[model samples]
Target: MENTEFRVELVRLVDESYPVVVGRDLEGSVAEFLADKHPDRRAAVITDSNVASLAAEGLLSSFGSRPADLVVFPAGEASKTREVKERVEDELIARGFGRDTVIVALGGGVVTDLAGFVAATFTRGVPYVSLTTTLLGAADAAIGGKTAVDTPAATNLIGAFHQPAAVFIDLDRWLTLSDRQIREGLGETVKHACIADAVFFEALEDAFVERGLSPAEFVRDDALAELTARRNCEIKRDFVTSDVHEGNRRMGLNLGHTIGRALETAAGYTLNHGECVAIGLALQSRLGERLGYCSPSDVARIEALLRAIGLPTKIPEEVPVDRIMEAMAHDKKGKAGAIRFVFQDGVGRLVVHDGGSYARPVAAEDVHAFLQSQV
Candidate 1:
């Protein structure tokens, strides 16, 4: 038998921060954590239809109590809404669950977000654990503890900051994801390296672009997957812990999200989050070129890596440029009449303005022109 446990990372906050165990074959360790930490608490596992039959089933069986499972909401970004959340909460109530329940979020980012939200409010706050099975969740979403569901007006409009008791990045399950899923998750992986960890960024380029290894191949290599996932969490933790609740400090983490999220909304969610972020990253690099934040070579290198990883570096023709512009104005980070973009200085570097803000206000007209030029 292989002993699979490895290093653990901590978020470290003002009040309390929890440990994130990063490794492969984490099912046994996850079960042990809940058993020792929660004792008699019932785990009301939450996941979506896509994941209910996957890791969720095994995770539930691992529970010492063999605790009852949870409802399988329809999967996809569409399910990340208030209506689905209301129904999940209702189902838990009907099952007689209470404050003693422990939320086991056993899927990708969607499950992590929706389930964590349920924990934040159910009985006014119950402990939760994230067995993040997807590469996206493992690299980014599952670590932050920011929980929310979307509304028609915008994404994640209603949410709370409820950190999990523990987080497990189960790399064993990540192997089950498709090649496209692997590429999508690398959007965050690349984003993590772009903002911090220059060495990690170069390594990604060398492996996926220069040497021509595919995203799927990279993730399948245990050594590569473990190091990449671990680095992503560390970069995220560095920013999140310093500004847990609200501070301009953590805004740097939004590197490509500002435009990426807007494009996602404009595209009507047809494009997955990671795909949209890849485009946003390319666009930001272009903007950097125009603004002298980065050179033409920098833009080329960034776009080449994104393309090599099987991600989109250009805005799709089907997604109207004007709609993307409109969505930006409504971005949650937008101030007054301007959108503050987290621009890049170059590959592996983000721009921080003289005012000490990671994102700076860009003229909407300039952004409009940039969109026009791209199309």
Candidate 2:
């Protein structure tokens, strides 16, 4: 029998690697960065109503002689919907924006997600940059190429893998974040540490304890904040580079996101994403212990770190467990009503399930039992 043979040439779909500028006072560099990276593109700064007057203004001012426009939507998670994406896209069309337009996401996770979806779909796809304002945006949302808007059914259910032209992390922007917003960012930072870097987790813990700072206060500390932002980006970069399309290996990055997204959807946009993720991490870590994949001490340690940062560890009494489970069943990671959960073997490591998938189908009964324990 002749072996099947075919010549395969490697074709690179994405030719350029964008820079992630992480530092204080990086606002001055935005225009220069755009000039260097996308000199001919028209700029469309997409921000939320809350951020329009804050970091958004600074970003627009930095545009210098470059042609740019601002599109601000109502602030909050409720705005991260298909309706909002369409509205922004319509604004771009009405303004005569073309394929050469560059979308600048100028707020937290929601803005990035919505504006990114718009960029991803506009004229098929367009270049975009993230000028992250909130800590959550800096640490996670703005880094990975993953972009999406929420649907009535689930969080980020409809989206695309549209890489940004660049990502700007201006540390000074975080000063304007509320304490709750700071905690929201810490949620992703903690997940990054738990999934891949024990040392990072310890560093964050030590920083909080040594300085005697609450989670919110700790996020405001210059030294710790910078380190956290840089480290989280590095960890995410490793995952994204290893598996740009999520395939299997990158699914490890979804450690707590499986259940976390469910909680966010069930809460109806009330619980900020990072807050819901903190709860998901705590519950999943506990589940890992129950399944004998990790030690009870592991669960306790994770919960303690999250609590230290003022993140909630338990399911809110008001959020329905059944609703969460239903949402989990419909999660993008799941298939045919089966829920795929990513569990940790220990801090800084994910447990590879028997089939070698980073995601495992856990029994609904087991998940229900765990939720009951949480309350």
Number of the top-ranking candidate, with TM-score as the measure? 1
- Clashes in candidate 1: how many? 0
- Whole-model lDDT per candidate: 0.85, 0.85
Worst lDDT run of 10 residues, candidate 2, spans 208-217
lDDT of 1: 0.85
Model 1: clashing residue pairs?
none
Which lDDT tens digits does candidate 2 get at residues 46-120? Answer: 999988987776777888888899999999878999898889999999999998999889888889988888989
Worst 10 residues of 1 by lDDT: 60-69
Which residue pairs in candidate 2 have backbone atoms (N, alpha carbon, C) closer than 3 angstroms, thus clashing?
Answer: none
TM-scores, all candidates, are 0.91, 0.89
Please give the distance, in angstroms, between residue 263's alpha carbon in candidate 2 and its true position after superposition: 2.9
State residue 204's C-alpha deviation in candidate 1, in Å.
0.6
**For model 1, what is the error of residue 211's alpha carbon versus the real structure, in angstroms, after optimal superposition?**
2.6
Residue range 254-354, candidate 1, lDDT tens digits: 88888899899899888888999999888888887898898999888889989999899888999999899888887768766667888777777778889
